[model samples]
Target: MQATRTEEKTAETHGGASSPQPQQRLRDKKVGDLIAGKKRLVEVPYTASLADTINTLVANRIMAVAVAAPPGQWIGAGGSMILESDKQTGAVRKHYIGMVTMLDVLAHIAGNDVAPAVEGGGGGGGELERKMQVPVSTIIGHCLESLSLWTLNYNTSILDCMEVFSKGIHRALVPVDGHLENVGGVELMESASSYHMVTQMDLIKFLKVHEAELRGILTRRVRELGGLTDIVFGVTDKTNVIDAIKCMNSASLHAVPIVESTDEIGDDHGQLVNGKDRKLVGTFSATDLRGCPISQLQSCLHMNIVDFLEKLLDTPQQEACGLRTSTREHITCQPESLLREVVDKAINSHVHRVWVVDGRGLLAGLVSLADIIRMMRVWMLSEPA
Candidate 1:
């Protein structure tokens, strides 16, 4: 996506040689602009079972979804009545209790009590099935670490939205075409209305579209940026899928890097030590379980991570689940790589993160969408007022 080409097309249409400055144009853009023509928000009722919630996420190919409470439940929520769009019925009002992500589901499944049930023989499968039938509301508590869904006005500036995402909130709800009310000087949605879900990827894509204006920052090396996390959580190829999920839940991560097992045994918590020497093999993420049948989830969980990822990629349903075709191959970059390279890889590959490796392809660190957004936020703030 070339901003220059877009500008040229605009120039041709208007017959104007000059237009607003790029930075000023970006600043003037609002959250509404980002979601102008996006599909209506997809939400699951709070009463929906965990299995149903997983179905919705897989069917929609989304990592997270808004969980809505039935109408009239917002009375004492301390805010205006927010509404959500229903595909079957138009204009249904509901209170969005919070957002639920794939990680949350994994966390719930990998909880201490549930792990043993799934790992145990005989009645384990029955226990897992029973747990899957539980209400999705039971898992909302796991979302606390990732923060609850934040509501933003459609008229909010893109920069403001970026600031919110920079704080580690993966997604936010932006009410569109809704009346706003002032509640103690804070703008709140006043009535039932539709909204668009804005994610960190949206902001990254926005930046990618305007890369021409961010050449200075993009040209720098990843090492030059200060937010890269050196401490990475991962599992070995020999680790069971269940243990991998457990590792992700324990570390509060959406994905975990898979490396070749070392002779030195790690601790009981499944955390890999000596991260610098670990060889990058593949990644296991929450999304990998998409399209998996609830009946087979237990069996899948018991398979080796390496074998499971391979079979997952080879399945005909993998494409529908949104797994990249090149998933079998490691998508990675080095610390010396330019930031632009990492951003392009992330956006192009449709992956949330790119594992950073050394010259020998050993796990070095990790760069996430949050890290990229934070870099952009820092750069934006350092600009002249």
Candidate 2:
């Protein structure tokens, strides 16, 4: 028979030993100690066609690819021979000139004046149909200059990597030697990679797996977590559709939260959107720009954001976006919510950043998967060595 409470109490009275606690492995793990299975190098050549670039991105399930061009050249990519290290400092030159994403490709085509209308379809034949013919060099213009791409190296610590991810930035590039060298006198040569990719998604996956084993994780609220620095750039619902898009492009943002605007918004920079009782209403993403009417593409710039979203929601599949009409409410979280809950919400919703609101439901800030991971690193660092 199982011991009764009386017996257990007696044992405790007699000074019975407490059960041993489980050992922690997550605290010791470093980004440099990234799981052997995940550290892979995938890149495309500068000369690769736009069609091939899309195919490569789809095949690898990656969002962006590095452009490999020669040193002193303006462009570079993943696995390109252009990246080389300074022998004295072992730092690779910033030959990494550009990164191309599907969103960038899609946005460029949709915004292109030359993009012809499809006879029966709402937009061009398809999003990438006509643009695929163009070379990447021509199609992907000014992206490298626009995107504030962060850098990483093979030896980057998980704690340090967390700093970059803490921002809403989704990806980072790791520069390698791009030369084959013997590994500790081994016969075979290993390629010194020019570039590799690390994403916020990767960091989130790492945390979810070990969530159960971590102590005080669920008990702690996000309000207490540190290093959350996703710079929340917002747009008023009254802002011009084109102007909102420009804000996103200039900041290289994936999504801009929509807050209530007090005044009429347009290209006029004098319009200052004062946030008083206003709060986040919705969001607009690059995905929203896909499948827009090719004819109305130019006019959409002047269309009010609220009007755009209403029109978009009415026929998203056939019109200005992919955001589902069914998903009218954007996913959000409270600052007082548990950290563990935030992680679960992000994973389940598959959202990169969760909007953090205050008690009155005002937009306080945001927490990304990177922010959570950064906190985990902080927690790890806080543990006894």
Candidate 3:
């Protein structure tokens, strides 16, 4: 009897572990599925000037473009990343090098090439010569097919789609054949803040209203708003990490607001720090949650209110995160917190921006470190007056 009982117990344990595998297998069964795809390639001429290329990058808001020889010459290569463009010839004197990111630009500006001029010349007069560039085709991985991922049909259930995204890709480029040669569809990652997925009719209406209002406000200051909050296209804190990410891609916003509840400042505790009061206990800025585990977020939601508030006290600033100004503390106010306070804080604490909040403690606007310098310039100009 004892021998029989042991065998049964072992079998139960084995069965339990095996159950999830079948589910995962079922979920992953459609590896052969295919969908629509599109080719979004940027090819830069070898002789193209760096200024023109950078201009293209700036205009298109794209990080990198393919670098190819002029016309039909695929055998030879020049560079991958194109940095400087010549004003006179309009030929881009790009680096015959590797990949380049916004970080490269920031590093060049902050490092030995400090005060590199952004205007004029290809590599002659400006700070353009210091940067490195490369050809896009050479660096585009080992396989052309690898550049894109196969996507499921649009009719696939959202849960199934979510499973694909959870497998760790921001978006998938669907192809017509089981091959990536023919591009067809785009399956956007699911986002927690996205109201589109919510079937509830009333919630959708509320989101539309809120979005319209936010858009109206954004129209006034797209360029002026430098921080991530300034460009957050989606808002939701109640969602799992996957949901928030999906909203980011769908909204095409650089920043996404992770709020407990969009209807009010705070209502849901799922993403909020404190579940007790209907207040913004904490905020999950994109920068704050980047590369963090979703499991940790649950604990963050349950943290003490004071600790949550304390997290906000530190500057969302970094030594070299991006071009957007970062602040050590939230300090923007009416008439602006005395210019002296702004200057002193920036210099002493190494902060790059000072956020202005209203009486309700909600973020109102911001002032950049550059803005402070500009103010000083204005002061110097007024000295003679």
Candidate 4:
């Protein structure tokens, strides 16, 4: 009789911004300014087939490719690296290159072929040809918003890098400082085992080691559990109810980890977070909470934010949830639970976290849609980046 609140709210908020504009001070920043020099970039031949290139890149889920060399020189390299002849050619070569990404591959597949555009008469016509040879440096930071241009320098920090990635848009290029073309040390994947190869053996070993102390305490052990680390979710301390809606669209992940400055609370330097160098702050997981607003959740949900954030903040292990919350009380289990369980938790609960716990209330590793998909043996899919 209330006209279905979710549908009514969607109708009310569908078209545009909910609030009036605030003319805030804007920071002049580019992707180059945030380059942490951390991401491993692969250089492929300019003439590499789109299909082959996409296969390699999407297989690893890498963000981008530095298109270098031509079709001829790429034969021996097999679509990995490129070579340069001159020391002074570094700046010259870097600007001449175009980076390819999953978004780029999608764009290419969608038929926005920059190639035909550069060769002259194709839809956009003369403009594509004019822009083809234009220096990458010139267009690197040109933020037309729709174009999604950004830049990053070489010395940026990892936190800064994650911040850039959280923006949830495809960037054209990230140029480094001092005109360096090739940056080493950021290895995307070392070997097959180093990349996508995970087995039940590894999970069993990890579970055994962690749950060793509780061997006699817990009822049963879980074997063959694994998930993707990249698919993380969190909430923010900076956000209130209004801001929460804004951050939801900021990243691909379904949850947002909430954190506050430990320094502000005068807590010990790092007593809580496994003695890590970083501060011990709170975490909000979609598994722990959901996409619902804190106010609405408080009224309907059983637990509170402090209780929810505490679960993810604990030491990250299979049964980490047991350290704080009694898993038996909160978690619901169906013996018939499938991979879809993870997705259901994220969607129904509005959180991106799902955990595996045995009868005794000990922890098992968390699971997510990304994790379930990755572990799907029967599916034809690409590897994680």
Alpha-carbon runs more than 4 Å astray in model 2: 1-24, 30-44, 47-62, 69-97, 102-134, 138-156, 167-169, 173-196, 226-232, 263-277, 290-327
- Candidates' C-alpha lDDT: 0.74, 0.58, 0.33, 0.33
Q: TM-score each candidate.
A: 0.83, 0.63, 0.28, 0.25
Residue clash pairs of candidate 1 = none
lDDT of 1 by residue, 210-288 (tens): 7786787899999988757788767887788778787777667787788787567643435544455588888877878
**lDDT tens readout by residue for model 4, 1-385:** 4756655565567554444344321111222333323354455555566545544553443434455553233221122222222344432232223444433332222223222222233443443334333332222212222232233333333223333332333332333232333332122111110011111222222223333332322232113233423223333333332233223323323233333434445532112211122221343322232222222222222233444344434434214222222222233232224444444444443333454443543222345433432343212112221
User: Which scores higher on TM-score, 1 or 3?
Assistant: 1
Candidate 3 lDDT, tens digit per residue, 1-385?
Answer: 9977777776687874433223222222232321212234344565554434554554443444444343223332222222233445645443222222222222222233223222343322233233323223333322221233233443453334433443323333221222333222333221111011111121112222333322322233322333222311223334543333333333322232332355645443322222221222233333333222222323333343334334434433222222222222333432334555544444443334444444665544445443433333333334432
How do all the candidates rank in terms of lDDT, highest first? 1, 2, 3, 4
Query: What is residue 33's positional error in candidate 3, in angstroms?
Result: 58
Lowest-scoring 10 consecutive residues by lDDT in candidate 3? 191-200
Q: Model 1 off-target regions past 4 Å? A: 1-24, 72-92, 112-123, 145-147, 178-192, 265-269, 272-274, 325-327
Q: Candidate 1 vs candidate 2: which has greater TM-score?
A: 1
Q: On residues 298-371, what C-alpha lDDT tens digit does candidate 2 reach at each position?
A: 44545677677677665534322223322257667787788877888777755667887767766777887767
The best candidate by lDDT is 1
Per-model clash counts, in order, read 0, 9, 36, 20
**Which run of 10 residues does model 1 get worst, by summed lDDT?**
181-190
What's model 2's TM-score?
Answer: 0.63
